[model samples]
Target: MNRSETFMEPENFVTFELVVHGFLVLIIGTIGIIGNIFCLLVLCRPSMRNSINCLFIGLAFIDILLILSAFVMFSLPAFQVYVERKFMWNVIDVYQYTTPFVYPIAMITQTASVYMTLTIALERYLVVCLPLKSRSICTYGRAKRCVFTVIIFSTSYNVTRFLEYSFETFVIDEERGITVTFLQSTDLRENPLYISIYINWLYMVFMCLVPFSVLFLVNLRIAWGIRQARMERSRISSSQRNEESLAIMLMVIVFIFIACNTPAMISNIMETFQIQAVKLTQISNLLIVFNSSISIFIYTTFSRKFRRILLQVWHRKRPEDDVLFRWKAEGGPNLTGNRSTRTISARRGARVLTATTSLEFQREISS
Candidate 1:
């Protein structure tokens, strides 16, 4: 990889590339809006759903915010030119001060989302594997506290890097009217203005290693919890239903985590092993884009209800301005002629269906 590798764009780079990239961005942004908003709706519904989904819903919302915030860079005219260039590192993209904000914002948002996933995993692990004591430790209040803790810790993890970016460690050069920033491996040799290896190690550990370690252990425990649930509930408890719900959600997050971070891991490992490969770095960088892009798919897979609600919300006209909730009333009887149906709200345990709510409610209540 040469520092002077000039990347030339096609003759109609701005026109064709912008059209394609803009459409792609709009589609992703639309899905992000719908998915995150729908997750928020599901979280706000009632005690049961909220209790289980508060962390996940928050995660969904953060992922949504990450995608939305990325539009700032993606929408900028520089993005068109940056992507057109062959080398991302050589391109003059975001402003220097903006790097302090944008880079950490992206990293922290990602870290926070994964932290929430870890919390969700641990919660499921305890509930499934140690049901007796889980009740004592994993209450809704405790879960809420954990959510706050993740936000705090992960946000702090990225903030440290943001501070480092401002210390004049990086050298900015103007090449062919393009400002390029080089993130040198180190700047603390004979002449040291501010950069140090200790600081670089700090960046590596927090920005990469610790978060990776946490995600691995958390996802592993989630798998263990899933297996334990299947074994323990095989006889009569019918724990598959519960395990399926939690597993799908956690698995989606874990998969996305892997997709987003695997490239970076490979590059980092190559460096650790003293192997040289620029292709690996390029591949990993591409994965970062995929990591950000695949979030909508994750939502669709983990949450069937989220998918349904998102479709409805997207198709519905003036949904944001509307107030009244109109649901399909799942499991409602398909009535025959000569019988009109009217649904009315009622207090708990009260009859709302022709004075004849079916036995399903009874079965649930008894169970």
Candidate 2:
């Protein structure tokens, strides 16, 4: 395990690997770009602009960047045709020359996306579990600042990546003068200590374990808060219900992160232990990409506001019949036109509970 390790290029093209990775890159990248863009469009709306939505927009933006970068990284090699080997080799050469730069951007964007998700979970946890404190802590201004800090931290932190990896050309055969391009780590090529610490400790512990653990625990608190509020129906105002729904969506996203990212995390750890995990790493990478790509679907499915806004943007038609919730900072009762206010007094004998939206009031009245 103390010995230096490096990635060496294969002498011959592994058709299966190229095909599989290419397919994943093509499919996932296309889906991710489209979905993230749609989410961006929906969340960017003034109605959706808020502290939590700010984090989501940041996450979507980072995910899009990561996906597009990964797409180019994976798809470049898939175009290798026997007849066009010369042309493709030139393409590979260009990619290899750019690997040092591209890898850092990918790493930084991926890290930012993860932090953004964690920030989101933290925001939801506070909003659901500690509503009053969250008001001050989870302001839109604060969220924007947090996102900027995350980007700065991720970018600055991953600067070490430039020192870690480089593209090296290796001669596989001298008779035909066959050469292959490889992405090798300088630290791994010269000093094994760096990767041992970087991957095993910094990446496994700080990047993977700590974040996931915090997300899991925070989401658990959010869920518990929701359950407790539901048990005492009167404590659950329309705004609180909205918080609960948002919490559920956040929890689902965290679950997907754990599910999609666990394999890659484990693979990195396994490699650190000197277990041969190249295939596992490749598969895990696909899952990681997929995890990043598929989040928009979760947002669209779980958030009605997201869907309505999407439809509004797409069709240029407002479906007024579709129920909408307009959350207000201050709770009050107001009546205008056909809209009416409804109150559900808390069983604990609280004085009044106000609905967050006209739609919720109408529904409660009808029910």
Candidate 3:
């Protein structure tokens, strides 16, 4: 095919792939990478560390990997048309050399991210809908284990992706000394049984069907649980209210996941039926990138604790400030002790009261 007929053909000097998956992804992915990094930093803090946040930390880290891989696989190639021939040649050389590994890494991270999000949903369901059992079931150690297990499963499931492509180097024009390398598919990648079972059926089942179904159901239960909790707002403790808020935040995340992932799932179904959906697939890829990029915003908007901790990290505030902020925001200290401890508690409360009154006075003056 001529350049004009090629899929990467430019429209007004910019290709569709370049515009959608390349330049757009470059901008969004950069923001996502930075946002996920901030998420990691905020989630790691003492105040934010918990079972749910641990899973969030894993999700954020996987997102960073996925975004970086997307940049290399999709975004970098978009810039080839804008660079000098020599630079483009080097870019192609680097891309070719790294594609085999990058492709598998991207797949692995993407799958891990999907499962990680699922894990978060399941964890939230247990906590919010099955609160009585969640006390025993959900713990920091268990969350870490779940994260590790998902990583292992995602990696093991995608192991064949590593063998799917083999790198080949050859001279395109010996006279002009132009040499290039490209990834060539292996026999295993072409096998009908492998393609049908692993690539088509299993991918649809595990990556799309199962996660989406479970997320939908779990989110419904979570939403219902939050509704029930709101009815008894007067009886619920501040901590319980915080947990409910976290659950609400997670529901929003799952909602976004479903919305962004629906196109990709539909595209997969079309491809499974031997239908050509190139445009749909491109749109799906864009949405997937977008989905991976927006979790930080959801957390910021829906979880007050996340916002507070994020601000604390950004401002380099003391840990005590976090406690005081929580106490102030929640309307009291979430303290637990026996009657024998009232003396010491009252002394600490007096100090806290004095400090809080002084801070409130300063705030009133500033306003």
Across 272-363, the per-residue lDDT of candidate 1 in tens digits comes to 45566544554454344445556456656655545554555567633322212222243233344233432222221133232333321221
Model 1: lowest-lDDT 10 consecutive positions: 358-367
* Model 1, runs deviating above 4 Å: 1-30, 47-49, 72-97, 165-200, 232-240, 269-286, 292-296, 302-349, 352-367
Give the TM-score ranking, best first: 3, 2, 1
- Candidate 1: give the clashing pairs: none
Global CA lDDT computed for model 2: 0.69
Give residue 25's error in model 1 in angstroms.
6.9
What is the per-residue lDDT of model 2 for residues 1-367, given as tens digits with 9 covering 90 to 100?
A: 0111112434244443455456776788788889888888877765565788888888888988887777655555444332144344433343456667777788888788778889989888888888899889988899999999999988987878778677778999999999997977685536767767775678887678889899889978888888888887865565666677788888988999888888878887887787876556666767767877887788777766676668887886553323322222232333332332333212211222233333333221001
Q: What is the per-residue lDDT of model 3 for residues 1-367, given as tens digits with 9 covering 90 to 100?
A: 0011112444533456667766788888889998999899878866555687788899998999988888877666556644533244443444556677898988899899899999999998998888899989988899999999999999999999899889778999999999977778899989989988988999999999999999999998999989987887768865676677778778888888899889888888887788866656766777778888988888888766677667878998975775566445644433576665766666666677677655433221001
lDDT score of model 3? Answer: 0.76
Q: What is the TM-score of each candidate against the true structure?
A: 0.62, 0.76, 0.81
Q: List per-prediction Cα lDDT, in the order shown.
A: 0.53, 0.69, 0.76
Runs in model 2 with CA error above 4 Å? 1-13, 81-91, 166-189, 317-367
TM-score of 1: 0.62
Please list the Cα RMSD from the true structure of every candidate, rounded to 1 decimal place.
8.1, 8.6, 7.4
Where does candidate 3 stray beyond 4 Å? 1-14, 81-94, 170-180, 231-234, 321-367
